[model samples]
Target: MNGRISLRGLRAKGHHGVYDFERADGQDFVVDVVLELDLSRAAVSDDVADTVHYGELATALVGVLTGEPVNLIETLADRLLTVCLADERVETAEVTVHKPQAPIPHDFADVAVTLRRSRL
Candidate 1:
């Protein structure tokens, strides 16, 4: 049985941009992570030990997202994917990083980067 865990609209402030102003001032970033895994053991055992803790995953992602300055969202997405895949139970991860207040002059909703990774 495949199970999925999703974390959405995680807010954080970080220095990730090409321009000095963008890097210096920082901005709000939203992260969405989806993890795919087999949960048959957890379901049958009825024990938290048999499954991945979502809080731990969120904390790990926060550490990487806020740890240092990243040049691009692509790099950030890659880092997030690595962090998610670190878990032995996770077979696949889909990460999306959203930057709401970008430096673009024109009207736009937001800028985002999405990446999908598998443990093959």
Candidate 2:
């Protein structure tokens, strides 16, 4: 429960936005994920089976990012949390969804939404 797994800058193209052109042309989305769990077993055993496989998690999330066309990043973050929490090893999962090319009237660096889920 004291260990952490952080996956950052996971970029993928997605067609999710309020504007019609955004959904039509698509844009890059950045994701950051953090998993809280106990890594003592994997630390001592040096086996992947003792812990969650982040690669598989990333692949699954990428599939979701490329598959659906959600209207908001908040919804997407919730969806990503669902995937992150699917791993039994993860006691708590945090998902951050970033939209860099949002339709803002003024110049801005990025927009993002973060959500956290915990297993009881």
Candidate 3:
């Protein structure tokens, strides 16, 4: 359960925000995901089937990132976590959604939401 797999700086376009312009034109959303799971089986067998595949995981996460438009990054992060935890092998999932081009007028390096969930 302590073993971790992470994907960082995943960029996708999504129409997600409270602003009408945001939903109309869309903006870039960046995501980072960390999945916790047991890797012993894969280590012992050297078989991919025993572990989570990074390529497939990326595609799935991207699907969630671009699939629907939500009003909040919190909602997007929650959905992204769901995608990460869909694999039974994952015991815990941590997701961060970055909205770099957020509607704020002030100068900011980044705006993000981080959420973590553990399997029941």
Candidate 4:
């Protein structure tokens, strides 16, 4: 009865860091979201209405990512989790925000933040 909807590696350019250069020039961010919900109706009816619309979710995420300036990926992830959990059908959500080109001087692959939330 449980189903998951996932959107991965969504690319966006936004200002999300501490440094002036980071905030001014902006950078590319990757976002991934997973939503858990009941899928029995969708399974039985074979209709899109019974399931979460991932395209709409993605569009909403893009709006959040580009709409405001955040200082941390953790904040971005929290925002995404909030957006996902706003859906009535969703019981739980997991959001990950990735910063590939971090401004760190040391060699590193990437930095990311992940957060989980459930309907109360």
Query: How well does each candidate superpose onto the true structure, as a TM-score?
Result: 0.95, 0.95, 0.96, 0.94
lDDT of each prediction vs. the true structure? 0.90, 0.91, 0.92, 0.89
Clash number for candidate 3: 0
TM-score of 2: 0.95
Clashes of each: 0, 1, 0, 0
lDDT (Cα, 0-100) at 107 in candidate 3: 98
* Model 2 ranges with Cα > 4 A deviation: none
Clashing pairs in 3: none
Q: What is the lDDT of residue 70 in candidate 4?
A: 81
lDDT for each residue of candidate 4 in 19-81, tens digit (9 for 90 to 100): 889889998999989899999999999998888888888999998888698888888888888
TM-score of predicted structure 3: 0.96
Which of 2 and 4 is the better model by lDDT? 2
Which of 3 and 4 is ahead in TM-score? 3
Tens-digit lDDT track of model 3 for 3-108: 8898999999989999999999999999999988999899889989999998999999888878889999999999999889889989999999999999998999
Deviation of model 2 at 13, angstroms? 0.3
